[model samples]
Target: MLVSNVYRPMVFGCRADEPLVEVARWMVDNEVGALAVIDGELVTGIITERDLVGALATSDDPASQQAAAYASTQIRTAELEEDAREVARRMLDAGIRHLPVQDRGRVVGMVSMRDLLALETWTA
Candidate 1:
């Protein structure tokens, strides 16, 4: 199956300069695992729940105001044309739940492990 079959366009997103606290709060409020980090018209990075928890775990204060310090700038992405199985495999192998889907260098949609699992033939 193709990613477009299950892609969600209404997913959460944030700018690179957005405060990490805002990102964290968006994840909590939306009950999602990650948010796509947008850089102008490009999909730059992704900040996941795991990233947040990891940052908090190593930090002396979880609620400190240094939000930007906790957000992750490194990200992995997949093309909208890629097969769903490939996306799922990447997510599983990386132990991540979110994959930012880009189309022609623009942020298009996001795919979650949950979305993949709900598919009829997701193996990862």
Candidate 2:
């Protein structure tokens, strides 16, 4: 199965300058674990729940921080036609839970561990 087969449609994201509080609220409202950090049309980084927690724990004024401060600049992306199993393996090896799904250099969706595990159940 391709990533397109299992990935969730409509990538969730926040601007790099978005406040940490806003990012946290967005995650809660969207029911997502991570978000792509976009600067205009570019996907600059990825911010996960772990990042948020770490930032909150370390920062005296968490509200003053932005997504760019906590988001991981090194992000792994998955092609729409890439094998889903391989994507899962990549996530495992990278110690990441989410990957932005891209098509022709444009982000279209995101695939998470939950999606991959659900696929496992179906394919098994």
What are the clash counts of all predictions, listed in order? 0, 0
Q: After superposition, how far is residue 6 of candidate 1 from its true place, in Å?
A: 0.7
Return the TM-score for each candidate structure: 0.79, 0.97
The candidate that achieves the highest TM-score relative to the unseen native structure: 2
Residue 20 of model 2, lDDT score: 97
* TM-score for predicted model 1 compared with the true structure: 0.79
lDDT of 1 by residue, 1-124 (tens): 8888887876477877776677788878988888877767665667778777777779776665343455556677778788888899988898878887778766677889888888845544
Per residue, candidate 2 scores C-alpha lDDT tens digits across 35-111 of: 99999989999999999999979999999999999999998899999999999999999899999999998899999
Pairs that collide, model 2: none
Best by lDDT: 2
